[model samples]
Target: MTLTEKLTTEFRQRCEGIATEKRSLLNIRAFEPLPADLLATQLGATILTPKQIPNLNPCVVAVLLDSDQWSAGIINQNPLWIVNNPRHTPARRESNLMHEFGHMLLKHKIVRFDPDTGFPLRRQSDEDEATYLGGCLQIPRRGLLWAVQCQMTQTEIAVHFNASQEMVQFRSNVTGVNI
Candidate 1:
């Protein structure tokens, strides 16, 4: 779905507020990069790989280790254990982690798996909200504006934010801030 269709103006503003609040809690300026690792640390969230999941089935571990299709997911809520795909690149990993963090921040319910198919039964609206909030957390509107003001290129902004070039472009498009 298009960004506008998924996120309302008020919802977008709320996401911006959340991002700003998170940054403030970390003592990070709006223009500064908020690394996913740092945020996870602050949130007391533990990041793990498939191998770290104790007593996992060998077949499941093999599948997780070999696949690049999955990004990340929240495996535990109380202690906040997130399992990220080690196969993805660093930039993609950051984005994946941010997306997981978005779900946590928004208090999205854990996706339940279908007993018949073993596929996750997800709520599209929740996924959309998490996606939008993830983008906001990765590249806040104010941060995009600051980067633009500094005459940063798309690659520069991506590198600065530890985001993919596509994410930087998406932020620019959603925020109506040309880079």
Candidate 2:
């Protein structure tokens, strides 16, 4: 199988596990938004905007970043604190938070900061996996198929699932669904 196909399978399995463990339906048919905040709460992780973090640098905060930039990261390992970029749209925020949750679920190690850049560095594999899982959490393949079967447009599916249009398009590409 292709790397994306493998990742897709793994993501689906993880979604099923999360659903079963959390006593929530996968809800692939309804194109429902996955309760990422609820999942974070259940996992004992606190989600916060950059401004909410104590003594954070104002210049580097979420409000200053571009939408296409990195949106969130796990700042603490023990207490599990996540910092999400608030400047992003609500749908992007959800995807960002879900990406951090994906890291937590995958047990990715705390990122090592680059001394020169002062930015955390992560393995490409880990990043790819988390991104894939986050996208899956936002829009499962079954959900995409259901949306297609329902004659939903990309915008309609994005709205229904609380996902960005880019996310909808990405899902369509990955799942080979025309939407």
Candidate 3:
């Protein structure tokens, strides 16, 4: 498998393991605010912020990039970045950060390439997986499933989990139920 594939597979495994624990996944109340430094450490990356590295090489959480910026990752040993698009709900950011971690874990295999002038970490399958598992990391499938079984609208689920509308929509699709 390619780096992205391998990373997604492994990440899925880790997520499964997390699913095994008996903790209440619905206990997820807020955005699960991840510290930039801690998130970098969790992903095993040395955090380099915009302040430390300047616009060219700052490892950014890009919620909004004009024509020039990408969200997250290391590029050519220079700027490793992530998008901080406010368009994403706070929960979206949480999942997105995890997706960004996928890139870091996967991309080091080949030489770090320069930013594509876009945060194209994973577009199709890779992007989908990242976002999928990112949602799982925030709210596990089992718990969310239980919530669905308990009769919650996608809007209610989104509200309860503090997830984005799109995330709740996707999670519902994965469950293959019409709620």
Candidate 4:
């Protein structure tokens, strides 16, 4: 299998209620960008929007606060902040934070310096892994299975998961799942 598929499969196994209806109050965010504050809380991480953080770096999504707060998520210092506005869909923001969390979880740190751009460096695999993990974190394969088995249309799943319709459709194709 391809690396993305492998990583996705591994991540899905971590979920306990992939195929069943959840009884917990914690809702599964589909396409909604989780409120930065709430997401930070859920992950035991903190969000330091453009104003809150100092000594920031470029392309730096956010600071991963390890000592306290949610288990993981970003603290984007500046320009990259996309979670604040209601104009932008919540699903997108939630997905972005999760993606950044994947970066921390995978130990994707700046390893070197790019002389050409004078920027910090990271592995391509690390980048890919973060993106893949982010999506899988939000959309577990087993949950996808349950949704499909329930005959939820892609759009409905998108709303249910707070994910975009496109993501839901793509996931359906990727998992060979049917509704």
Candidate closest to the true structure, highest TM-score = 1
Q: What is candidate 4's lDDT per residue for 110-139, written digit by digit as tens?
A: 345688995446576776677666666566
Off by over 4 Å in 3: 1-14, 18-71, 74-83, 86-88, 103-111, 114-125
Best by lDDT: 1
lDDT, model 1: 0.92
Clashes of each: 0, 0, 16, 23
- Writing each residue's lDDT as its tens digit, candidate 2 over 1-179 gives 44366566666567545544443433333356676786687789998877788787777664445445668889898899998877788988888987887788778887888999877788987887777767777787777888888899889999987888998998788767778
**Which clashing pairs does model 1 show?**
none
lDDT by candidate, in order shown? 0.92, 0.75, 0.50, 0.53
Residue by residue across 1-179, what tens digits does model 1's lDDT show?
A: 68767779999899999999999999998899999999999989999999999788989999999997788999899999999999999999988999899999999998888999977888888888888889989999999999999999999999999999999988888889999
lDDT of 3 by residue, 1-88 (tens): 4333444456665653543331233233222322333544544454443344345543333423432234444433333544344444
The runs of at least 3 residues in candidate 1 whose Cα sits more than 4 Å from the true structure, single-residue gaps closed, are: none
User: Which segments of candidate 4 are over 4 A away from where they belong?
Assistant: 1-39, 55-88, 110-120
Q: Candidate 2: where are CA atoms >4 Å away?
A: 1-30, 57-68
In order, what is each prediction's RMSD in angstroms?
A: 0.9, 3.4, 6.8, 8.1
